[model samples]
Target: MTMPIILPRQEAPVAAIATPVGVGALAVLRISGEGVFDIAQKVFRKKNNPNFRFTASKGFRAHFGTVHDSEGLIDEVVALVFRSPNSFTMEDMVEFTCHGGPVVVQHILKVLLDEGCRLAEPGEFTRRAFLNGRIDLLQAEAIGEMIHARTESAFRTAVTQMQGTLSLRLDAMRELLLRSCALLELELDFSEEDVEFQSRTQLQEELAGLQEELHRLVDSYQHGRLLKEGVATVIAGLPNAGKSTLLNVLLGEERSIVSHMPGTTRDYIEECFLYEKTMFRLTDTAGLREGGEEVEHEGIRRSFKKISEADLLVYLLDISLESYLDEVPLIRDLLERNSNARMIVAANKIDLATGSEERLQKLRAATGCEVCALSAAKGEGLEALKRLMSTMVEGLDKLHEASVLVTSLRHYEALRNASDALANAQELITRQAETELIAFELRSALDYVGEITGKVVSEEIVNLIFEQFCIGK
Candidate 1:
C-alpha cells in the first residue's frame, strides 16, 4: 500500500497572473488560499453596490466589481469566487478578470500583493492541484505538454494523457501487481505448510499478462517521445549540395541562406515544419568536405554531432557532381555510428542532372538505403520527400488513438524499471526461488509503478517535475 502524500501547510494566499502577460481584451489574475475572499474584499467592490460583501459570495459565483487602491479606482473588473475544497487548488480562490493592459494588470496584482497575497511561484497553482489530490503527476505533466504542443498530433496526445488514459492503464497494472504481491506474501507466511496461495502455473500466466502490458507501455515510449518532441532530422551532404535549399523548400520560405558558393553554410540552421500532422525539426547542417576554413571545420564538427543525434538523416547528394559516389563512405560511416537513425539518400539538383533515375539507383545500391530524386531549388519531388518522411513516422498517427501511451521520459524510465523487476519475479517463480525473494522483486515492481502515478514519490521528484511548468500554470 502507498502512503498518502503529506503536503506542507500553506500559511499565506498565493496570487499570480494566470493569463499570458501583455495587452489583450482581458487578463485573468488568480489568487488561492484560505481567507482569499477577505483579501479580495479589501480591493474589490461590486459596481453600484458599495456594501456588497465578497465573503458572502457563493463558490463559482462571478460578481461585476471595480478594484481600487488608496488613490482611486484602478480597473473595472469581474471577480470570480471559488470556495475551498472545490477550487482548482482546493482552497478559497478568487480570479479577477480585468482589461489586459500591462499597467492595469500590474496595478491589480500590486493591490493583491499589498493586501497580503504572495506572488505565486512557477507552476504553483498546478502544484497545489496535484498536492491537493486534484490530479496525478502524469496528468500534471500532460498539462505541460498540452501547453507546449506545437502540432495537432501533439495536442491530441497530450489531451488524451490529461484525460486519464495513461493513468487508468497504469492503475490497472498496479492493481494486478499488487494482487500478485499479496499472494506471494501469503505464500511466504504459510511456507511451513508447504501450501501455495498462487500456483506456479497461475503465477506464470498472471506474470505473462502483466509483462505484456508493461512491454506495450514501454514500446510506446519511442513513438510517444516523438510526438512530445518533434523528430530531429538532419539535412547533410557535400558543400553546395542544396541542403539549405531543401530546408527552404520544405519550410515553404527562405529560412536559410542559400548560395551557389561552396561552404556558404558554416553552421547548422534548424526549423520546424508539420508534415502529415507530425512535426519534423529539419536542420540544415554544414556541408561535409575536406580542409576548409577553421569555421567550416567547426561547422563540419557540429554536422557530425547532429547526424549522430538525428532520428532521421537526409543525406543529400548533388547529382550534377561527378564525385557523388565519393560520399558513399561518409554515409556508411554515419550509418555505422548512428545505427538507430533512419537514412534517406536524396539525389538533389535533379533538374540539372543527366539520367537522374540512374543516379538515384546507383546511390541506393551504394548506400543500401532508400534514395529519391529531387531538385530543391525548383521544388521538384519535394512532395515525395515529404511523403517518405511522413511514412517514417507513420505509426504515430495511430498513437493518438491509443487509450494510453507513455510520453514522459520519467514515466518511461519508471515503467522500464518496473518491467525489469517483473521479469525478475517471473524468473524467480519459474525457478521456485524463496518466497521472500519473489516478494522482494514484486515489491520493487510495485514501487516503480507507484512512482508513475505519484503514489510513492519523493518531494524532490515532485518538485523537479513541477519546476518545468511556467509560473501561474
Candidate 2:
C-alpha cells in the first residue's frame, strides 16, 4: 500500500476552552504541542505532591492538581495527558478540566497564554488531525459539517458521511480504477504474448456499471444539497395578506413584523424552520402591487428578484379579498418568468373568508398549481402546508432512499468534470484511437475524479476547507 502524504509541521502553540466558557458544572482548557506538560506543570500545584512533575509522568495518564499563579491557588482541576505520536495532533496534549465559570475559565486560559501558549485559530486542532493522518480530507470536512448541523436530516447526513460510508464507496471505486490501470500497463509490456489481462468486452462492461453508479450518486446531490443547506422559500401575496402571520406561525416566532396595514412589509424578512427532518427558509416578502411609495415599489422589485432566485415560491392569496382572485394575471406573469421554480398557491385568512374553499379549488384548477387553504393567524392547516413543501423538494418516493449522498458542491463539480471526461474517453476508445490518447483521456478523468475526494488537491484548497471550521474541532 502506498503511504498518503502528511502535511509538514507549521508548528505553533495552541490552547482553547474545550468546554463552553459559560457558567456550568465544569470547563476544560486543552493545550497541545511541544512543552505542553512542562508549561502546564509550572502553573499546576498538586495538594498532595507540591513538587509533582507532569513532564516525567507516563503517557496516556491523568493527574489532579490546583492551578496557581502569583495570586495563589486559582482552581483545583484534573489534567489528562497524551504523549506524542499517540495523540490527536501527533504532538503532546494536555487537557485541564476545571470548574465552569466565566472567571475561572478566563483565568485558566490567561495563565496558559501567559505561559507561552497561544490561542488556537479556528479549526487548528482538526487541521492538525488532518496533517497527522488521524483522518482524511473528506472526513475532516464531514466533522466540520457535523458541528454546524441544524436539523435531524442535516445531522444524519453529516454523521453518515463521517462514519465512512461515502469514504468506503470512493475507496472501492478508486481501487477498481487502479486495478484497471495496472492491467492496461501490463498489456502494454506483453502485447506480443497475446495475454488478455482484461478483455475489451469485460472492461467495457465494468466501466458501464461504474458510470451508472456514479450518475446515481451525482443525481442524489439535488436532494442532498437541499437537505444540507435548506430550500429558499419566498412567501408572496397581495396587500393585507397573512404572509407575515404564516411565517411567524411556522417558525414559532415573530420573525416578521405583522400589522393590518397594506404593504407593511416593504422588504423581505427571512427565518429558518424545521419541518420533520428537513429545513426551510421562509421569507415574508413585500406584497405585490402596481402603485405604491417609491420605497415600497423598490421593495416589490426586490421581492420579484427573490422570487426569481427561490427554489420554492408560496403565492399567498387573502381569502377575504376573493374578488382579487381575478388578478391572477400578475402571478401568472411571475410564474412565467420563473418557470423553473415550484410554486404553491397558499389561501390565507380562511378563518375570515367563507368562500375560500371554492376559491382554492377554482384557483388550483385554473392555474394548475398546488393549492393549500390555511388560516395563518389562527394557525390552522399548517401541517398540510409543511407536507406539501417537503413533497415539492423531492417526492415522498425518494425520502427513504439510502442515506449516502453527495452533499458537497466541490464533489458535485468534480463528478461533473470527471463524467464529461469519461464520455470523451469512451468515444476515443470506440474509435480505436491511439492507445496513448486513450490512456491520456483516462488519466485526465482520473485526475478530475481525484479532486472530489482530495486525492489530488492543493494545499491551498485544504487550508480553505479548514478555514470553514470552528475552533476546538
Candidate 3:
C-alpha cells in the first residue's frame, strides 16, 4: 500500500482586528490556523463555565466569554468557533466580538499576540483562503473589487465574479482543451501505430470554436476596465468656455470654482458621478490656448495631457464668442492627436446665442462627431447630454445580461495568450506538422487557461494577486 503524501502547511497561526478602527458598537478580532483553539483557551474565559475547554467546543458554536490578559480582564466578548477543514482557510478559526473601543480592542489584540498569535499582514487571511483551496485567485480579486466598488454596476459585477461566473466559463474552456490535448497525447503515444484518437479536422473545428469564445472574452476587457475604473471623461476648451460650469452642473454641486474670468481654473478638477449605473470620472481641465503666463502654460500643458489620456472628450465651445471659429482649428488638431478617444462637441452658451441651430450644425459638420447644444449656466439640455454619456460606454446595457466578463487585465492577457496558442495549434494541424509540435502548442494553451483559474499558477503570481487585499479579509 502506498502512503498518502501530506503537503506541509505554509502559514503560521495569525490574528488581526477585522473591523475598522474607531468608535463603533462592536468590533471583531479574527484568529485562524492550527492550535487556534489553544490560543483562544489561554485568553478567553467562559462566562458561565470557568473550566470550559475551547478545543472541545463544537464547531460553529458561539460562546459568551471575557478576554483576559495575564494581569486581569481586558474586555467582555463573544467568541465564535470554527473547526479545521470546514472553516475559511480550512483551519481552526475564532472570532471575538468585543465592545468597540480603541483601548479595549488594542488590549485584546495584545493579549492574543502575547499568547503566540502573530499579527496578520495585509490580505493574509484571503491569501490563506486561496492557499488552502477555499477560493481561487479570481474570487480573491473579486473580493477586493467588491470592497472598493464605487457604483452599483461595479458592485454587481464584482459579486457575480465572486460567485465564480467567470471561473465556471474558464473551467469549461480548459476542460475542452484538456480533452483535446489528451487525444493529441494518445496519438503521440502511438506514433508508430499511426492511430488517430481524434481526427485533425474535428480538432481544428473545436479549437476554432474555443478561439472564438476566447476572442469575445478578450474583447470585453475595454468595457470591463471602463466599468471597473470609471470612464476618464475630460471637459476641455478655451478659457471661459463654461467647462467648470458644466462640471458643477453635472455633479449637482459646486465642486469646481466657476468664474467668468479667463484662466480661473489653472489646473484640472475631477469628480465621479453615476449615470445609468455607470460611473463617469469627469475632469474639468484648464483652458487650452496659446500665449499665457508660465503657470497658465503649465496648466495648459496638463490639460492637453488629460485630453490625450481621456477615454472621452467633452469639448465645450462658447457659442456666443465670435472667436469660437478660431478655436475650431485647435479642436481639429486635438481630435487628430487623440483619434482613439471618443468626442462629444458641446456648443455651450446656447442660451446667449440667437439662432444657434445653423452654428451647431456647422460645428457638427466641422468636427464630424456627436454634437450637443446646451446652456451650462442655465442647466438646459443636460438630460440629453447625460443620455449620450451613458450611451457612449459600449455594452453598458448588456452588463447585467452577460454572465461572464473579462474584467481583470491578467485574465484578459491570459485569454489572449491561450487564444494565440490554440490558433497556432490549429495552423499546425492544417499543415500536418509533427504531432510533438502540435501537442506542445496545445499544452501551452492549456497552461494559459489553467493560469486564469489558479489550477496551474506560480507562488509569486498568487502572492501578487492577494497583495491587493486588505488585512483580516
Report lDDT per candidate. 0.88, 0.80, 0.87
Candidate 2 minimal-lDDT segment of 10 residues = 394-403
- Quote model 2's TM-score: 0.86
Error of 1 at 203 (Å): 2.0
In model 3, the clashing pairs are none
Ranking by TM-score: 1, 3, 2
Candidate 1: segments with Cα more than 4 A from true spot: 1-11, 189-195, 252-269, 289-302, 354-357, 364-368, 378-380, 395-401
lDDT tens digits, residue span 24-107, model 1:
999999999877888999999898888888788888999997999999999999999887777888878899999999899999
Angstrom error at residue 402, model 1: 3.5
RMSD in angstroms, all models? Answer: 3.6, 3.8, 3.4
Please give the clash total of every predicted structure, in order.
Answer: 0, 0, 0
After best superposition, candidate 3 residue 266: deviation in angstroms? 6.8
Q: Quick one: ranking by lDDT, best first?
A: 1, 3, 2
- Superposed model 2: Cα runs more than 4 Å off: 1-10, 179-202, 259-267, 289-311, 327-342, 387-400
Return the TM-score for each candidate structure. 0.90, 0.86, 0.88
lDDT for 290 (candidate 1): 93
